[model samples]
Target: MPALTLSRGVADWPEQGYDGWVLLGMVTLSLLPVIRLFLQTLNAGSIEVAGVSLSFAAASESAAEAVRTATLTENLDTPEDMPLERTSLRSILRALRRAHDSEVTVVDLRQGQTWWETRLFILIAGAARRDRTQAIAFVGERNGTPGTFLGWAPPSRLLAAHLRSDPLLSAAHERARAKTAAWQLGQPLPNPHASVTPSVMLPWGTNQSLPPVENQTPDPAFAFELYLQQNLDRPSPESGRLVTIQRLRELYEVFLVTDSIDAQTPDDAWAEVVLTASPRRFFAVTKAGKFKALIPRDALVAALVTRLVRAEDSPS
Candidate 1:
């Protein structure tokens, strides 16, 4: 009986030690998160916040000063039908680089505050090829903002009005335009989008299904394809002068009519506008101007116009 009692006691002692070890482990696990938090707080405290300014700030100021020094007419007057000799962009880039005394080269200058780097070359080429005029703005991803501007069009008249209405993008445009050389006005250059001016506006329509003709015309289908490809940034239909669903239906037959095209379905809405004829061609009739069927690329004409209007109307 004594031997049995001793054996039972020994077993009980082992159980107690095992329980103590489990308890100690639980305590350690509970405190670990708190210790981690304390260390993070200490590290955060070591970083000092200072009110540092960018060197570009001074460059921006100087650039603005140069622009303001001239009279409004002299400064604002842009030339008409100016064709790009080399890239007019080069002059502006050089000017900005000189003023800033930094490596600040011209990224894509499509709209206000928003610009692009070299990554957007294909997009720029596509935009330039599609537009005959009023395609000045460069659509590029820059500084986390997606925007537009008059890349080829002179910053005058209707273009100015569009800029005034769009507060967000227009402000950036104002800054960029101010920094640019005054001579860019009348030069024929690449336009990113249409301007409000009737002379420069190019309308895009989805009405590609025009009546059949004897000779086949080269479809401008690539225009819309290019437009869609470059416009990865999902712009809001209500952001600026966006075409309403009803208006779009009435005007063009094709569209990606959603707040964000990049987002997935059931939110996705895309449609194509084909001509009434066989192997349907694309054409859109607009009050601005006729985007001929020879260039199926004209399908994006209205869309680009709408995008420009939206950018011009949006506030910073």
Candidate 2:
């Protein structure tokens, strides 16, 4: 009876065609890895603050000059809900207007559409110095919202550490500082954001899913990667381990924006960059690149850093 039972069980296996089922299961398992890889590739997206692609093309010499003039003339530490001395503001508006021969137009990159008739407010703060770093906090939406974006000049080493881990931001901050510094130094600002990197603006139209001309133009993406590497290559004040992409993504929204989706895509105009420095934060934007200068993102940050240090050294 025992032998009969064993033979019956074995006989049922063939009757059920267990080998066929086994082969089918193996095939499914074998394809899973490939399927997963394909899905990952398909879902690839972009990373940009407030929906604007962080690229060199976004930077313009005239735009940077305009920003420099505005920053120099405007009150960098003006409080919200209060009107500052009109002299500087009017002068800034005049210079910017004459420089570009038009009214100032603030473009909300997050909305993907131009805010043609609305007014926008942006603030600039100072950054920490090596010997006496200030303690500034960033306000607004840290997760991804857009509101008063801020910039700061973190010491070079700290900036580099952030880069090895967070290439996108590191790239943005680096390029911004470099260009802005050049502008302040009376040197011609370069288009550092032009290096190719994947980015998707917020409020992107339905058709604006992946990067524009992604497959057709891979050079930009490669350029972005190179720009990021360059961030690491630069001299820094301190040294630390390189951060993984995942870790950097965690700190992605550190820019501290006030809201999200201020504009929409394809037909949008205007681009804004925020600088966050300890005890100080600021933002720079281009009214219209067609007739203006590139917003100096990095240079603004570095300037803020220097400003913050100077402020701290001054009497309270």
Candidate 3:
């Protein structure tokens, strides 16, 4: 049997595995700038300011002046909503050309379609390459806020590869490769919801029809596992843990949302969310890559049940 080692502070990751601290740390690091800038924007309310990007900026009309960020917008259009087709992006490029004549342009990587997961990235790259006038830079978002800045496509490929090859992103990348293989080779997709790990999304219920566990009370976690199998696009389960009723308790706090999805392939955009409930009871984690960001599924059923009971008990 192979040995399993786990560490909270260990930054070294295997080709495929989970590290709680790594996940949390990566997110925390990305969040620092977002927190600081958000504070600056809030404090700007009391002070006098002219039209500017944020309270941090002074008016400058130079070509290198502002780095327009898409995620900074309150209602950012998710990749699902964007028209990223090559032809469409080309049209946007032409339109942008006529409107703004500048030495450089900063575009959301999501819109540029150059991020690894987007099917249009390679296509978007061609367009970006052909643009003779303007140089481009890309920015990635964290928790609906902008932070990580991936530079222009031509130079950033190696850096992007390094970041995306990490355990979590690799899981998404591996899945994309498999689906691509299955499509090109016409191989049997034994499980359409297939993943590199036993996913929290649970796609096995269709193949497994075992009789109920005899004389045992229904386990919410087990039941939830079964529930997830019906949808294969959901996030894969974390390594080193079984989905148990006891495990599901972490997500039982009051929450305004109840949804989540896991990235299993390369074509979907990637995002991870951490919702720390009031008073630090526990944190709820959710992610969407190659799909819409959803509420966490690990504790979703429990959270929903909590909400329903609370709603029903209130005075009618």
Candidate 4:
């Protein structure tokens, strides 16, 4: 038998086809483990594979956990028995920063006050500053309180500022005020839930036999009017005729007129309105043109008809 000669050229590889197929099979089998390991690493929270490391799930979970913790702390009332920790201040600040743009109802729980006795505030401007030393600036209105207050309180004191999806008891409060106003004015009490003035009076007084006043024409202009309990602090030319701002441009105009007319006006007059901070309550600084006079937000007889807006033609 002649001695076998080995061919080294590329074209001669097919001659070793059986050995080549076996080598290819072994290489593919070896790579399958690496591919599976890569997939596993991707799915895992934290894993090291073949000199590479991944922590996708771990990082995501950490962020999610922080938010959940903050939310839980905010919603649940702090245990009366448990003492507050100094370290928790950092977490509170973090939560405030996250919820900066949103309004919150802060429940101050000190001095063993019961749930009803505990001071409640609707806080705006959630976090004042980023520094630990800085006090959080807030415009807060306590429940059943007459005036809106401006205060700089430590973040730690804001123990449970629960985020609310709706205006804080605004509709109910407005309806209650409207009913009271109608009784005082001797007009028919409007429907509790009706936005528009009702055609018929729902009998509501000590004696339910009061006759409905005839020829009552509800003025369309004053349809959204709020009957305030007290007059605004600032006096203007149109103050007595006014009942509510009614529009953004009107508010801007009223601010201008008041600032010009009032002797004791702040340099930044708009800041006064901002301090009220409740969306449902428009701070009528002064009155103008059949609009309601300003009073504390809590004393308003109806929900604010107009929202704060940036009007193109608004006075500077």
- Pick by lDDT: which candidate is best? 2
- List the candidates' TM-scores in order: 0.16, 0.18, 0.22, 0.17
Ranking by lDDT, best first? Answer: 2, 3, 4, 1
The regions of model 1 sitting more than 4 angstroms off are 1-90, 93-134, 138-270, 273-316
Q: How close is candidate 1 to the true structure, as a TM-score?
A: 0.16
Q: What residue runs in model 3 are displaced by over 4 Å at the alpha carbon? A: 1-102, 110-134, 153-316
lDDT of 2 by residue, 1-316 (tens): 3533465587753344565665577676776565445323323432243333332232333234434232222222333322332122222233223323221222222221211100111111012112122211121222355433332222332334445553444454556445333323342223355443333333322211112222243233123222332343344532222222223223333532322211221212222223112233223332221112223444433333333345456654
For model 1, residues 1-316, the per-residue Cα lDDT tens digits are 3533464587653354466565676676776565445324423332111322212112223332222111111101223222222122333222322323311112232222222211122222222333322222212223444321101221132233333444543443343333222212223334354431111112231112211112332122232222222232225332223222232223222221111111121101111221112231222111112111111212332232233345456663
lDDT of 1 at 149: 15
If both were scored by TM-score, which would come out higher, candidate 2 or candidate 3?
Answer: 3
- TM-score for candidate 4, residues paired by index: 0.17
The segments of candidate 4 whose C-alpha lies over 4 angstroms from its true place after superposition are 1-78, 110-126, 130-316
**lDDT to native, each model:** 0.27, 0.31, 0.30, 0.29
Cand. 4 Cα-lDDT: 0.29
Candidate 2 Cα lDDT to native: 0.31
Give the number of the best model, judged by TM-score: 3
Give the Cα-based TM-score of candidate 2 against the true structure: 0.18
Cα error of candidate 3 at position 10, Å: 70
Model 4 per-residue lDDT tens digits across residues 146-209? 2222222334333222122123323322443464445445445455643444433434534211
Candidate 2 wrongly placed segments (more than 4 Å): 1-65, 68-139, 142-151, 154-158, 163-213, 220-316
